[model samples]
Structures are given as structure tokens and as C-alpha cells.
Target: MQRVLMAAGISEDVVSQRPSNRQHRLVNKTLRRLEKLHEACADPRLGLKSSSPYLLELLPETASALRRVWEPYRGLGAFTGPAPGEDEAVFLGLHARTLLAQTDRALLLFKEAKEKMFDETSSYRKDLTKLSLLFSHMLWELKAIFPGDRYHGNTYNLTKTEARDFWKMTFGNKCLVRWSIFAEKLRCVHPFQEGLESVALKATLDLTCNDHVSVFEFDIFTRLFQPWGSLLRNWTQLAVTHPGYMAFLTYDQALSRLGRHPRKPGSYIFRLSCTRMGQWAIGHVTSEGDIVQTILENTPLYLALLQGHSQGRYLYPDGQDANPDLSALHRPDHKAKVKVTQEQYELYGKVGSSFRLCKICTQEEKDTRIEPCGHLVCRRCLDSWLQKSAGHTCPYCRCDVEDTEPVEVEPYQPKHKQEKESDTDDDHEDIELVVKQMASLRKKAPERKTAQQ
Candidate 1:
């Protein structure tokens, strides 16, 4: 269960002398690093691949001082969620507050983190300086543990640009999911310094929102938290209604079998999702001769998916019809399974383009920038739009346009005359049509339009 660190001077302290604040933080940083090394060694699923090039590297000097925590679980079982409860969080906050468990301290800390760190009006959302402050607040001793600590006296901290970009990415889309993804990414960026997962549950309070008391409040999460081992112990104990379920089949194992047998396209079997434990996923052979899988958290039985969705998905390895016996057990509520990214690829050609065309018609040069939503529209087209609607609307995001700005093009001071000639062309029928449309719109006194409503 433990590995003894053998060092001549590193004897256990006889005196109960309290460590200084800086020493405590430094030791915590070291302990965090050691924790990562131990997990890397224990989990073969990781393939010992360092998330960062600098992380998971062992130094001969620290070998004698490093201790290994016993980890018996591997593969699917390895994910024993860090802060599964108040106990785990209490264990983590021990060094600072020895009586953390005796009181409601763990709950308070988690509540504080949820409110101060991840709340909608959090200071990290304000600006870079505040975000950097958060970096220091936690066990993030970035400089001492990363590139800066050893190399050319370098001070490697996050830049304003990186800080701003991180905020946009993590808070840009869905609420909880973005933060979860952000936490995952933050782990890699600073992996060598200290681990993030051990502290993530505390940070996210096991993915609890600020207003909510527990994540178990959500039913989908209830199913998600219960690992597959609890549902059916082994293949022999399979109680799943979906006949396609080849119980406990790993993705690699399924892929190998399908490759060897060479089943027809759309042949699929329901298996435990590799990405999320306890979740049902389809390991199906696609028309493109590839085996693909995606975990659907909400739906337990993929029978509805089998019965309804074509998605090039057929039940069993032989592409046979669904067994009436299995279909009778649990009736599917939804018409069909929700489409995943790969499933949508067959229908959608391209997602989006790099060219900043007007999102309304998707055919004009974006000349006027709408404020708040930051959507761009051609000025003449926008004038007619404002006249008709009598209310400002950003056709792109559907946000009520508050203000407008003319998109200024910096004068192209090209070094070569040939470059200017090469850039300008007469072949743009699309651009000319847009230009004609811009000219035709009756010139309403050129003034900035402001729409509060």
C-alpha cells in the first residue's frame, strides 16, 4: 500500500514543528507532482504518455524522496473519482486545517470554490490580472514547477491573450461542460507542476452548480456516477434489454473482432462507453470502413436507437433485425437517438468558413460591425433592414443590436507593386453583385443607428 522513500537525511521528523506557509505550499506543490507520477505508473491506459512534454519525467535526485501510493485499479476501474464526497475533500485540506474532518470545513471550502471561482460573476471572468490571482490562490506554483524553474531564469506566466482566450473558450458555450473541459485542458498545460484532477472535484464540487447543493440533483448524473460494474458485474450477469450488447466489450476488442470478421456496414453492438463509465455506446462499423463509438449519457437501453435511427446503424454484428424479445422489455420514449458529431458528418459537408461574410444572407462582404453580438453586416443592406424592422437585430446571432461601428480596413502598404495587382481581380462576380446591392439601397443620411430595444 505504500513505498518507503529511502534517504540518509530524510528521517521522519520527531518534533511536531509546524511548517511555514511558504514551506507548506512548496511541499504541497511537490506532493501534487509526486501524485501525478504515481497515477501515471499505476494506470496503463495512459500508456505513460505525458500530457505535456515536460510532465511525468522522473529525476534521479528525487527518486529517494518520492513515495508511491498503492493503486490496484486499472483501465475502466481506474476512474475512482477524486472528490467522490466530503471525505475526499476533507482529506485534501488536511495539511492546512488538521481538524478539517471534525467540522463542516470541507463543505465550506467546496461551497466557497463554487461561488468564488466558478460563479457567473466570478473575478476570473473580469480580466487577466484577476485570473492570474486565481492561479496563485490555488496550489498552482506554475513558475517553480514548470519551464521557468529550471531554464534561463525565465518567468513563464500566462499572458493576457492566453487568459482572455481561456475565458472565451471555457465560458463561451455550455455552462458546466465548458468548465469540465477547461479543467481537463488546464491539467495538461501545467501538468508537471501539480495535478488538477485531485483538486477538480473541490473546484467544481463534483460538478455542482453554485445554486445547487449536490450534482446528484440531476438524474443523468445519477446514472453517470454509478459505474458500469454496479449495473452488471460481468458478461454472464448481463441484464441489458438491448440484445446487441456484447457485455463488457472494450472498444479495441470490438474493433479487432469486427476487423477479423469483416461485418457489413451499419453492423453495431452496444458496449460500455470507453469515455464515460456505465454509459451505453454503439461500436458500429461505418460505411467508410471505420469502427466508431459515442457515449449517450441519458439513454440506458439503446433499443430505441436500434429500432428507430438508421444512421447507418444496424443491430448485432451480422446486421440482423432487432429481436422482438429484447424490444418488448423496455419501450423507447424518444423517436430516435440524438445524433453525435460523427453521425452528423454524413449529412453536413462543411461546418463553417474562415471568410467573414454577412451571416444573414451569407453572400456579402461584412462592412458594418454590430455591437454586443459583434456580428458584421453590409452598411447599405443594414440601413434597409433597420428601416423595415424599426428595431435593431443582429441577423447573425439573433441578438438585439445595441450599436454599430464601421469596420475599418487598415491601408495595405505593400512592399511590392506586383502584390497589389495580384490581390485585386475582376473575377469576383459575387463581390460585384454585393457591391451593386450596396449601391442600390437609397442613401439614408449616413448616421450611426442605435437600438436599445
Candidate 2:
């Protein structure tokens, strides 16, 4: 059925007739040219592709037609959309310290991004649109690894029956059978509202990677350092609960699966350990650097270019170059590494002012009280009630607050700034710095502080 569909759509001439090596070469060259166009759009360092007719010829008519639409604005460089910059590094650091672990970083990032970019009155249409595109690209990369006859776009809606059919046809193994069934059922009965498919898609993509990597591994990295948001939460949760048979991981895992690993000292046999599951899944991302090195060394174009250029024959001993070794320069490790662009950082401050409380606070607690009527209160105000209160009255309004029913409140786990508040004026300064720094990183405002009444 798939073959029939392909033949009908691609045409009999293109499907059955295999291209000669020369033809294949031409196609590869064209793909490289297309890549140049993409590269040009991403970074200004690469000169424009318009100068060379050969490069111009490489782009398919369809892509070429859309070239103007894809072009970045003057002075804007290529529109890789908003990314974090050095100024926003403080917030990034705060995130590494705060919600990176035990929470959805991407959602946090997205919320911060949305807050930074848009506002309560501003719909997230633009942010979601870009995010949807990014997610589609990620899915495309995953699909490339696991070839399928039909690719439903990120928006492909599958009925429960169709999803079941998809799984049965794609993966008939017993272990995966249950997963497929569950996924199909989940599709029919999803957790979130009908809207926000794009948001859900991004989260699903991230969650798919997380499941393969294991939630723990991803969480650890995000918690301590990375400062992305969890824009991909609902979809990710859905994917986690009802993932496709194929597991996804970081780009590093894909490289490892392709049989590339770092060469240990004096060991002819490359290490191949037992396939074990980590916090995300039973996959590997530990040796992406080696795979990248191998691809660069083995590729003919790389060698030819090395000879063609001023640089002599060189070997990559370990793949830790701050800059890219190849022309495309989209390194797997670099792409995987989370760094905020300047736009993202500046925008964080703009958006951070929108939310009344930071997104992290929302996940744990938010709007549990109203001011006067049920005035705003943070963990500090509630701490006193921890000792004695079936229901504590609002400190501001003195209204009979019935919901103050404390249930053996756990000891307060001071956030990153709290522990540091004890040191000195410097320490207090540090806490303030951390709070101000987090302003950019957060989508919502920090919980307001108040004395216990």
C-alpha cells in the first residue's frame, strides 16, 4: 500500500528508476547547496548564497519561490527566532539553580519566552508558530532515523483505530504492542483542551526524547544548569503516557546507534556496554563528540575541503571545539547544548514582568489565596499556619479563610536564593541579585514576601 502510494505520488519515472552515481552526486550537491541557504539564514558570517548561480540552481523551484519569505530582515541577521544572550545569562544561571530539575524547563522557557515576547493581552500566536516549526524539524530528524512510508505532519490527526493500525503495522513486537494500544487510546482521550496543538507538539517531541533518555537524566541537566522552558509539557506528558514504539533521545544517542563511539586508550575493541535504561530511557548520548569527529574524518568532502583550503590534514582527537570544524557547522553537540541568545535574554526581562508569579511557583502553588477578599500570600505567610490552623484567616482582609487547612506541611525547601540569604550583606546582595537575575528567566513574578501575622 505504501509503495503504491509512493509510486502514485512521486511518479513511476522517479520511483522505479534509480539515479546513476553521477545523478546521485548532483542531488547530494544540491542538498549541500540548500544547506548553505539554511546556513545563510541562520548566521551572517556565511556570505549570501545569491552571488553564485550554481548555488542558486541548487534550490528546488518550490524552495526558491519561497526564498523571499524566508529571508531575514535587514540588520536582523537570519531569523533563528529569539534566542538567549549573555545579558540573560544571570537568569539562565538562576534557572540552572532553580526549576531545571523536578519541573518542565521548556515550558518554563516558553512561558518566559511568551512573557518576554508577548503579554496577557498579546496572544502567543507568533511564539507558538515558531515553536511549532522547531518541533516539526525535530520530529523530521527522528523520522529520518526511523523510516516510515507516510509521515503525518506534526499536525497529523490519527483516530484511535488509525493509530492502532499504525503501531501494529510499524511495530508488531509484544512489548511495544501495549504501548501502541495505550497511545491510540490516549489520542482519543487527551488531557488538554483542543487548542494549543502546537504547544502540545513541542512538548511531545521533548517528552519523546526524555522517555528514551529517561526523565531523570534530562531533569538533572536542566535542573543544575540549562534554562529552557516547558512549552512542550502537555504534549510531552501525552507522549510519555502514550509514546510511539520508537524511543527518541538526544542527537548524541542517534550518533551512538550509528555505531560510533570514542576510542579508549590502547583498546582495539570499542566499548559496548549492556543496554541500560537511564532516567529518560534505555539509550545513549554519552559519545556524540566521537561520532561527529568520525563523520568529519571519514567524509570525502571534508578531506577534499581540508586539502582545498589552507588548513592541512588534521584529525579530531576529541570533539570539544568551541567552534565548528565543518562548513555546515551545525554540530550535534552544539545544537543539543542549551544556550540563550541575546534576544531571548532581553526578552526574558520584558516578559518576566508579565506573570504575577514565576512559572515555578505556579507548578507548586498559585492563586491559593486572594488579597483582602483572598489576598496574595506566599510560602512564608503560610509557614505560620503550618503549626496550628485547620483554617487560617486572611491576614490582610481578616476573612474566614477555610482553605488554610494545613496537612502536615513539609519543611520549606529554600530555593536557590534562600540558602544564600544568610551569609552577609554580600549574601543578601547575592539573593537580591539572584532574584533580579531570575526576573529575565522567569515568565511570572517571584512570590511576594510578607511577615507572618
Candidate 3:
């Protein structure tokens, strides 16, 4: 109950709960030391050390004049958005405690405006674009992704072809990147980081597609979630010799081009499908040296499945070079491998299952895919996150999640059920033997008094 209250911000730990005996003394001592630590700190060492001075070194009159500029916006939060706990944490650092008191005042003012003047209130505002602010030597950037925020307008949006080029050039052919199915049209990165880990699970979404924000199981260690900066790794050079995606070519043209190359059984070429924007047609030579073609879906997993069942081992234009050449997951050092021992399989399954669990609640599977970002999270968690967020942003990635769609995650099958049953039988036998031995031992043992003395 106390923990619940503390989490809800209704009560403090010291007020709702107390340590007994010596533990109480430790708590009081810790508080006293903390107070002393603050008291002994000098004014210069008090807050963040700015690299440069204030941008506006204004006189008293000038400051008042600046305040007057915002007078008209006083009813609309002075043209400000809701506070994100994080922006202040980065801007003021430890000094943000004083800013906390100001938040209540701000909330009260917003409420008073709503009550007194309904028509003038900010509550009815919609389609509010995500705003970013910059100040003096220290910059305060706010990324409060609300329901109607416009990331598509202010971000690096991409078309289907560009996104395809992105993949063919990088780890595009790899199974590890099957998660980037939604980063096609709109762009904005929500980096989820903890500790000093350089690689954070960054989520990107096409905000134009989805109508809501999203959340990801950021703590999941799957390779699918990588630093957004990884997208810049130059892999477009592969297309030069590979000739994988030959744009502006018809089926006959692709076939004509492949005919000129060496008559390798597995050699193939891909041309943009005339029907749709992101679709492609794969023209490949059969084992019998006859040409065959099929439409390729705009999904990495589908392409991977096709490759797995292909007559040729290598990618198009390079038979025997193999699709593995473009896959980082098949590398010797990669955690995910094609083959493993039975023990390794079970161990990986166990670990993978845990990783797939929703880190937010730690009780459900992250089986629902949030649109635009394509982040998998539980419905229960996503709904709860949406309710509490003043402006709906993902708790993990902090992305502007617009909508969610339910998805099917393959259930993990552990190979230890039979072994567990045998172990249980052994445990039962051991328990029976222990009980008999204890009975015999008790008959030969001396009695003892039950009194405290």
C-alpha cells in the first residue's frame, strides 16, 4: 500500500513507511548527511556549469518588456506546451527541483483559464505540432509527442524507394533488420538509453501513417533495436556490382540484362514492379538455366523467406556469393546463429522469451505492434501509458506513437519439459527417502526442551 502511494505521488516514503529499530537510525543518519552535503556546497558548485554566458544579458526594464511580449499568451500557457519531466532534467540538471513547484502553478493557471474562459482555453486545441525550443548557452529541446503532433512536417520523411535503397545498402538483406518495416515515409528518432551504453534502442516511425504515438520494450536486447545513427553506414556501394534493384526496368529488360551476364543457375535481378510504389519483381535463373520471376513483397521477412527457399545460394547477380554476405546476423560473433547444440537452443529460447516480455509491466508479452514505429508492446501497457501521458509519447522511445495494431509473436518452445518431469520424479523419491531417514534418526535421538532457556 505504501509503495503504491509513493509511486502515485500521493505520499513520501518516509511519511507512509518507516524502518524499525537500527534501520530507522540509518535512514535518519542518511537524511542528516544529505542535508549537510547540500549545506556545505558552495553557490558556484550548486547547479549546471554553463559553457557560455546567458544569451540575453538584459536590464530590469528589458526583462519586464520581454515579459510583456508574452502577455497575450498568458491564457494559452504563454504559447508553451506541456512539461516533459526529461527536458528539464537535461536542462537544469539537479536544479530542476525548484522548477517542480512552478509546474503546479502552471497547471493551476491552465486549469483556471479553462474554468473562467472555455473559448480561450488550450484544451480544445488539436493537431498541435511537436515543438522544439532552443535557449542561450544551454539548449532546452522539448519533444513532447502529442496525439496531433506533426513529425512528418519537420522530419526527414522518406518514400518507399528510398527506404528500400536504405536496406539494400546496409544490413537490408539481413533478418536482424526485419523490424524496420514502418520507417518508410516519416522520420523522427526516439532514442531510449540507459547507463553509459553507446548503443541505444532507437525507434523511428512514419508519423503520417499512424494516427497515434507508440511504445517499445526498450530493454529488449534483440538486435532489431539499434542506434538510429547505424542507418548512415554506407552500404549503397553493394548495388554497383550486385545490380539487385535495377530501377525503371521492365521484366523483359531485366531478363535481357541477366541474359548478357554469365549463365549462372542462381543469378538473379530485381526490377521495380509497375503496380505499386515499394513492390519489386525478382527475375532469376533456375537450376535448369531457365529464367523465372516472382513479385517481391515490400517486407524484409518475406524476402528472407524467399531467399531461404531459393535455388541459388547467393543473392541476385552473384550466385555462390550467398545472401549471407549481406547479413550480419550470420557472422561468427553474432549472438543469433543458424545452427546450435540442443542446450544452446534451449538456453537461447529461455533468454529470448524473457527478452520478449514487456519490460514496462514485466508481466505480459509485447505482442502488439505500435504503428509508424513498429514497436511491439502489450495492449494493457500501451493503453495505460497513453492514459497517463499528458501528451501521448512512448514511455520507452518517447516517440510520437499514433496507433497500435495487434500482432502474433511465435511462442517459445523449451526442450526441457521431459527433463523437468524426470527431475520432479527424482525429487519425490528423494523426499520420501529423507522422510524415512528422519523418522529413524528421531527414534535414536535424545529429546530436547522447548523452553526459551
Candidate 4:
């Protein structure tokens, strides 16, 4: 049995040995410190506090202390050593590192913004408020990234694609656009830093597709520089030489050309281009410390330059007028609303009536409808179904449904009774009172008769 357990990767000796008291104490101390830091960072009052300078100083010190507490347990082996607390210690260390990095990045941005603020800027307070909000947003992102022990190890080394998807899903498109602009600012401000451009470009492209070289295969070049160059090159070369690559490139080029056509006005391509232009404008204004003039004057010129750079010819041939009847193109269609058929209404009613009783328990009280599908289901029946099968579909129609708020239906009551019940309630109470009094008197009489006998 011991040999079998050893073969299964569990050593009895290692399992039997306990972590040292000193290691346990250290782990506990580190956890307490982390908990306190997390609570402080999560506190809403941190943002609302009047002393910004104090917070700026205190946060870094707290981050440094957290780093110091977790330094010794950074990569302690859990299985090989008698350190039972190693796993927890490592997880806490990674979480601390993530939080510390985020705090440092936010602080850098805050300090930069503060330096940019001048006496001429009347909206300094507003700018400071925006910076504070941005810092809070960064903290919120840290919470999401390091949700718990499960993600602590993996979040730090996420692939570019995974990071992009995570950002888009968590922060949304607007925030993603802002992040792109912010990354560009970071790249420009620290141009001398190694690999900053590549990192920024990768991040931007992950969020928004690159239009200029969207057709080319750049993965081959990236893989060629890696340690396993020969093997990767052979693999990537085969992919690049595949017949489908040419077909895909041709399709991509055709689509790109179509998108640039002036008359066609590709809405998606236009929106992407506009987003890029907006990012550029934001970076320019923020860095230059002249927001209004740059927006009013330079933005239009930049847009005009983009128009001039387009491959599509806006001019028509010979005697054709430029201002053709564009009104016809812009005309809005007034479509009438479609009404549901009587048959469909009757079907819905039948479905609703079937749920008057609980399907699982056969009780009469349950009457709730599933959302979007409008299929009726008893709450108890649904709960039982979820527990047994965990299925997310309407039982009657087998249509996919989400676990949303159930719409409850009141049990049918007679209209005449409902109206009269309110009036008769007081009378009913009085009659009940009289009956109770009579019953009490009868009981007393019986007792008195027994006493006389």
C-alpha cells in the first residue's frame, strides 16, 4: 500500500512530516499583512480622503512591506520539503507581487498627470479626480486578475490573446480604448526602454486589429528568434507555404480594398479608424497640455490627412456632379410592428396553465415563467431540475434559457369576491370575536355546574 501510494506521487514520509513552527508563524504573519493591505486598498475612504500626498507615500510603503514579508517564501517547494505552508506562502507572494506592480504603475501615471498640471489649467481638480478614479479602476482590475488562489499563479503569465480577451470582457471596449491610449503614452514617454514599443504594439493589436499588415504572416518572424528556432522555423515555413495562405491573403486584400472605397463607406473599418484617431488625439492633448486648441484645430486636420491617405478615389469621372442625391441613400424605413398571432397567444396560455402546479412535487402554489422563452415553470420544480440535471432549458420546449429572475403570476381570484372581501373583512372579525366570547361563557357554565354537584 505504501509502494502503491508512492507510485501515485504521494510520499508517506513527506506527508507525515509537519511544517516547522517558524515557517507556520511566518506564513500567518504574511497572511495577516496581506489581508490588512487588501482591506486598505479596497476601502472606499482611501479614494475619498483629503490627503492625497499621504496616501501616495503610505501605499508604496505598504506594498514594500508586503514584498518583504513574502520574499523568503517566493519559490519554496511544497512536495519535496517538509514545508506544508509553502503552497499558501507562494500563492500569497504572487498575489502581493501582482498588487504591488499594479499600485506602482498607477502611482507612476498619477505622478505624471500631476506634473502635467499647470497654473493655466482651470480643471486641475477635475483632472485629479479622473486620476483618482483611474487608480481605483486599477485596484478593481487587480481584484479581477487575482480573484483567488486558483488564478494567482496563472494570471501573471497570461498569453497575449488571453490577456486581450480578459481586458475586453472585464473593462469593456471604452476602457480598452483608453488603455490603448495610455499604453501609447507610456511607450512615447519611455522610448529608451527596451521592448516597450513591442509590448505596447502587441497590446494595441490584441485589442484592435492592425489594418496595414493584416494580410502578412508575422508569426514566422517572431518564432524564428526564439530558442527552439530550427524546429519552429520548419513548422512555420510549412504553414506559410500552404496553398490556403495565398487564398486568405487574396481575400484579406480584397476586403481591405473594399473597406477603403469612398462610396461604399465601410462602417466597421470607419469606426476602427476613428478609434485610432481618437487615441492619437487624446495622447497628443494630454502630453502637450493644450487640450482645447488641439481638439478644435489639429483634430480636423488629422482627419483630413487620413482622408487624403485613403487609396479610394472620391472623385467621379468627367461631367458627373459630386453632390448626387445622397438623401435617397439616407432615407429611413418606417416598418410597422408585427403583432403575435392568436394561435401563438393560445399556445403560450396553455404552456402557462400547465405550470399552475409544481411538476416535481405536484403542489398547486407554483406559477413562475422563464425569461425570454416565456415558458412557465414552478419554482420548486425548477430548483429540483437544477439540482438533479443542472439543465438550463425550458422543460416544455427544450429551448435554451438563462437563469434570470422568474416572472411570478398571481393565483386567479374571482373579481366579485375580491371586491367584496375588503368590505366584509371587519364584519368577519367581529363575528369571530362574538363566537369566542360565547364559547368562553359555555366553558365557565360547565365548570360552575360541576362545582354545584
- Give the top-scoring candidate (lDDT): 1
For residue 131, give model 3's deviation from the true position in Å. 40
lDDT (10s digit) by residue, model 1, range 39-138 = 4334443233332111233221122222111111112323232221222121122222321111123233334554343332344222212221222212
- List the candidate 2 regions with Cα displacement exceeding 4 Å: 1-26, 38-199, 206-453
**Cα-based lDDT for every prediction:** 0.35, 0.28, 0.33, 0.32
Candidates in order, TM-scores: namely 0.27, 0.19, 0.26, 0.22
- Clashing residue pairs found in predicted model 3: 169-235, 211-402, 212-401, 212-402, 212-403, 213-400, 213-401, 213-402, 214-401, 314-322
Reference-based lDDT, residue 300, model 4: 22
lDDT of 3 at 346: 52
* Total clashes in model 4, counting residue pairs 3 or more apart in sequence or in different chains: 0
| TM-score between candidate 1 and the true structure | 0.27
lDDT of 2 by residue, 1-453 (tens): 234323222223321222223323333343344444333333333222242112223224323322321222112322332332221221112211221121233244344653343332233423332332333332332332222422122222221222223334443321111222333433453333445653443344333332121112222222211111221231232133222112332333334443333442110111111121111221211223233211111112222233323342123212222212334321222111112233333443454431223232433332223211323334444445433555545544445542221011122222433343221101001123336657645533343322322
Worst 10 residues of 2 by lDDT: 265-274
Write the residue-wise lDDT of candidate 4 on 1-453 in tens digits: 344323323334322223344444444554454445444444453343333223354444444544444444344533233232332333232333334444444444435655443221335434433433333332333333334412232223221222223333442322112233434443442232347545534433332121111101121111111111122222222222211111111112223333333343211111111111111111111122221111111112222223422533212211123312212211122111112233323433443422234444656444444433444446667656655655666555555543222233333333434332221101011223334545777788889999999
What pairs collide in candidate 1?
Answer: none
Measured with C-alpha atoms, the lDDT of residue 204 in candidate 3 is: 17
Q: Model 4: runs farther than 4 Å from truth? A: 1-127, 145-453
Please estimate how well model 4 matches the true structure, expressed as its whole-model Cα lDDT. 0.32
